[model samples]
Target chain A: MNVPLPNADHLVGIVFLIMIGLTITGGVIACNANRLVRAVAGLVVCFVGVAGLYYFLNSPFIAMMQMLIYVGAVAVTISFAIMFAAPEESKKHGPPGTLAGPFGLITAGLLFGGFTLLALKTDWQVHAKINDGSVETMGKLLLTEYAMVFELISIVLLTAIIGALIIARRGRSS
Target chain B: MEILSLYNNLNTFLIIGALLFSMGVYGLVTRRTLIGMLIAAELILAGASINFMAFNRFTAPDPQVGQIFTLFIMAIAAAEAAIGLSIVVAIYRNYKSIDAEDLVELKG
Candidate 1:
């Protein structure tokens, strides 16, 4: 193998920064877009950026699921709903309430500030890992330790799909 | 140089999670439509998942626990989106509009 360059770490850092920028920018677009379709597009972008962050966090499995589920399934579903609902063009431009915009900004800002302070100030205790959180370990745990939760999630998904179909099908003219 | 190694630090991930959470809150509060609110809710869930994974990587003794929890969260979020979108569709079918302001039947 060729010798690694000293500046390779810096390049990785730059890429991380770029991913952060992508996430924040996408989030801003998702929140501020006037068109619902545009907002969904922003959501897809934000999710992709988040998947990058997951890769950085050392879990490629979760990252792949993030992209597959959030970007592929969820975003597409939202867009389809938008197409079905057919929101009026004129009404889609305004905030929900008169004070909602400023009040929301203030509330979110305060939350962000508080969380940042808490994260920075508190000394979080780190513990030694019993096993590497690799894909193999995760698979075993899902079948063994987390089996109950896994089954419960499947049940929830089943109910959700059935409920969604029923709800959407009700009051149809046909 | 320190900035380059920021990914190894826990605080960096925490701050990113906070940012995503706040953006989601803002979107949820200010959106004028149900689907918009749902999108924001997904952002909120994403932020929570990030925090969980971050802690899983950095702090927790049993690293797999947080991953499992995050996976569970994703499952729940998918279910929520399905139900919510269907509800939005139903409301639209009845009202012929999905605007949050127009659904004020109980606005006494």
Candidate 2:
């Protein structure tokens, strides 16, 4: 088998490795960090790395949206919630019971191992190309094929906004 | 194997996504505070999006479907976050603490 490796391919591989590192490291920090603010920072880092991976997946638009919506909007909103709702410092530590330590680790490790094995063992089939999956094509499909779902999502967004407002407003009268 | 071409491969993305998912699960199980659990949930959603994108890149005939699905996930996550944070705020107002253990009381 004569397979030519382009110079760009190597660069992409390195970047991919770096992104994976970023994602995993940030995930660790997000999960393990003691401080809430640090956890938020880790979340931001992980989201950024995920965005990079999306770019590699050939959807730069989604990559940008991932960064914008997740890292920008979601992370920022979470940080704001932390600032407002959380105390100045998290001193009230929960009793880390006997099982919390080893059990959590074992569970997460088993899950990760299982998924990794599944991904490696499965021989996924590639289907014929229907479209290039560009932003233009996505727009067309959204309007034509997925119009109902698209509209429903918008309705969901509206309801979420209203519900959030109502929920937040409830305590003022009490 | 060259470093850059790693993105071209499917297994790398799958492994990374799984790792993220595991971390999220660990956090969800271990975190004491609601906000921390929310962060973990976000990580889990991120993992799902990665899997969708990877499948789109490698196996899907219409790649745009995965992209659109990811976008929908993002929108849902945003909405969820908004509502969840609001609920957190309300809970904090009632209990004066955001810790999960503190807000265990139920009213009749």
Best by lDDT: 1
- Candidate 1, superposed: residue stretches over 4 Å from native: A1-6, A128-131, A170-174, B106-108
Candidate 2: C-alpha RMSD to true structure equals: 3.5
lDDT of each: 0.88, 0.86
Candidate 2 lDDT, B84-104, residue by residue in tens: 999998899888888787766
Interface RMSD of 1: 1.5
lDDT of 1 by residue, B25-72 (tens): 999999988888998999899889889988998898888888888889
Once superposed on the true structure, which residue ranges of model 2 sit more than 4 Å away at CA?
A1-7, A93-95, A127-133, A170-174, B2-4, B106-108
A49-113 per-residue lDDT for model 2 (tens digits): 99889887778889999999998899998998999898664675444567776787899999999
Docking level of model 2? medium
- Can you list the residue pairs that collide in candidate 1? none
Candidate 1 DockQ score?
0.76
Best by TM-score: 1
The local distance difference test score of model 2 is 0.86
